[model samples]
Target: MDELKVKKSPLERAKMTLSVLALIIIAACSKVEGQADLQKRQGEETPIQVVSTIGMITDVVREVGGDEVDVNGLMGPGVDPHLYKASQGDVGKLDKADIIFYGGLHLEGKMTEIFKKLERQKRTIAVSKNINPKLLRSGKDAGGSEYDPHIWFNVKHWVSATETIRDTLSEYDPEHAEKYRQNADHYIRQLNELNAEVKERIKEIPESGRVLVTAHDAFGYFGDAYGIKVMGLQGISTASEYGSKDVSKLRDYLVENKIKAVFVESSIPTKSMEAVIAGAAEKGHTVKIGGELYSDSLGEPGSDADTYVKMVRHNVNTIVEALK
Candidate 1:
């Protein structure tokens, strides 16, 4: 017996064609992805992936590693490293990073535990490790850190940090060791120039007018390096609260010293400094808010204070102009 022939509808024919095209596209994509993966595994010369907790560390890594590193800073402009916590997305980034760098010395107070755990699995370095503990300032509060973590404020110390970055990168990527050393040497020279400029600019301020008061004590290193007296409404960490007594004491000190201005940090709340100002005003002293200073973080992209050197220059200029 002969079977009857069946005619397919136009819609059915089109659907079948579309299904075949989809399968073909999927197969092609899979093949491409597999090939890419194979290439990656075949000793491809990709940039060394790095994740730095703060922009200053990121800037140094980029300057030293140059084209050899692909770096991402976890914290950006105006971020308070003392209180910044890593999100799930940040953890993902950390997982993929070949190396991680942080300010350390409890500067990254919240992420300290996370970094400690990450250190076991990957190369995690604290740039501040190279700093001499003797050079670090002692914390003022009863229950504060023994050593201050704001070493970057001292340009000379940061130059040492650049050496640590160079050695770490060279050890991890020996293939380009000479390149890393050369880059670091160049960057160190730039930092030296920055230090000289800072000293010269600071000289513009009168001896008695060199007091730098801010919302927090982030500039202890700055004060020590540049011969300025630094005061803050809060302690070494922003986590420290100020009592009315603390405010009154600072108010009396500012009035006695005839301080012209008090500065607010970019990452810290203005209320603390405002309270200090009010207290000083009540004591019959006129204190102005000096321009905002980039403390824990750098300024936004395209701003004059975006880079480390620029940030320092901007701060010095602001301090000198306000006080002079």
Candidate 2:
């Protein structure tokens, strides 16, 4: 009987060990299934695909899309989207794009007509065109081609457009509506904080010393944002001719204001800016060339100011340091 009891004890111990092993295997199998389901769900959900014209919109879509969508911008960093002419590759990109996002309000100068046709089909909206007329550059007609399209200069304007973007993304991807909302919320917060920071930095320089002279008139909205008078040798679009008239006008602004510094833009030709500086110095104003500012486009890859947030921050810091 004692031998039988010892044998039974060994058998019971063996049974218990097997039971634990079975539980572990069962649990692992359940976890594996769960992970598989996750992957399957992700695969089942079709991602919203977009083709954007400009860097700012591309940056916004990337921030909002995260992993749920794929976005490609036709214009790369420092490539002026305003003057971009569609290539065969661009046409192919447009064809494959489930939704096309182009900065409306004449931003993509030659591409406006292409986007307008899509708008009639309810496939596109003028993202920046919806901003209040007052906030845009003065004298720019509200509904006319004369309007300046650089609404991204004002963060408040950009935030408003972000809501439009959020709505558009939600309409197309109803299942991911909540996700888009959260992303837009986060991005808008960043923009708000950025706007405040820019305002604060601009305030460091007194009003009398507040003139911002640059290579182009891209900063009209920026000047309107911070109450600084701005003058540029060229027009809003870098494609505009930097005529001798524009250069002389910029030189005059620097000399008349006694402004100590002028700025060069990343996308525009700096030689004209150098001329402005030289002309100012000829008048004994001694204007220094400020650091490069991202105007028409953000910086190149791996740059400190590559992203929209960093671009605005870098511009503000450089402007403040130069003027102050």
Candidate 3:
């Protein structure tokens, strides 16, 4: 006897088709989720691009932003920000940056127009702009703005600038705001300690020998905060011309006061200070060239004054060792 063959019911076939469709939908959803996860990972891996005008600002951003930012400084070691002009390469860097930080009050006088133009297109900031006006020293640069931009010399003022950088970074990347705050707090504490250290070190110099004579007036804030008298051959900006009369005046002051050492600036030519030393020698006063101080720029990489903190410590050490 032969067995009878039977066809499957339509409902049973429909049920099998729906089961296959459901599997495809689930697989598709999983693929989409994997792609989303990859994108999120990629976003987290990318750092915020930053362009800073000077080394001090660059160091602060690095300290505060930590691993979250990639900073490129336009003016490197031994570069004068007051006279620094933006190159084509620098413009490209600025254009590509997510944020730009500069020392305001005409620190980068030649590049002011570039920063102004960039402000319209990006988050351009002047780190010194937010500092208390009362803390600022009046500028004597006839061709420059009305205030000195060397706020970093005073560690306390720099603490304010650090806070500004932290706030700006936090505003831009809210996910890393807490990280920035923590980093800033740590940095500020270090600065406070540094401030105290500087005060104590400065006191080691005899009260009469506490005068700091440098190539220019860049150390005004430093002298003010540390209770040292400051004199310079030229005005606040290196752009100011120091003529024979100015040199004579400084030379006479050194000879009259029996000052032993005057510092040459890293960013400035040593010829002017050398001239003053020579003039003093001619008048029977022995004056020596003190160690070079990092002014308007940081020291080269691997040098003692390369970073901001190191720069401050190096300057104080050099000054005290020479004058005390």
Cα lDDT over the full model 2: 0.81
The stretch of ten residues in a row with the least summed lDDT in candidate 3 is: 140-149
Which candidate leads in lDDT? 3
Candidate 1 lDDT, 1-324, residue by residue in tens: 889989999999999999999999999999999999998867688899999988889999999999999999999998888888889999999999999999888888879889999999999999989788888888755224777888999999999899999999999999999999999999999999999999998999989889999988889899999999998888888888789998998899999988979999999989988998898899899998998999999999999988898899999999999987
TM-score of 1: 0.87
> Where's the lowest-lDDT run of ten residues in candidate 1?
138-147
- Provide the overall lDDT of each model, using Cα atoms, as 2-decimal numbers: 0.91, 0.81, 0.92
lDDT of 2 by residue, 1-324 (tens): 455544458888899999999999999999999999999968887677788887788888888878887988888877876668999998788777878887776888888888877665556666875677766674242222567887888889889888888888899888889999999999999999999989989989988888888877778888888888887777676666767776787788778768898888777667888888888878888988879998867788889777888999999899989988
Q: Candidate 3 clashing pairs?
A: none
Candidates 1 and 3 compared: the better one by lDDT is 3
- Pairs in steric clash, model 2: none
Sorted on TM-score, highest at the top, how do the candidates line up? 1, 3, 2
Better of 2 and 3 by TM-score: 3
**Model 3, range 1-324, lDDT digits (tens) per residue?**
889878779998999999999999999999999999999978767799999988999999999999999999989899988877788999899999999999988898878888898899999999987898987998954334689888999999999999999999999999999999999999999999999999999989999999899988899899899999999898888777779999999999999999999999999999999999999999999999889999888899999988999999999999999988
Using all chains and alpha carbons, the TM-scores for the candidates as numbered come to 0.87, 0.82, 0.86
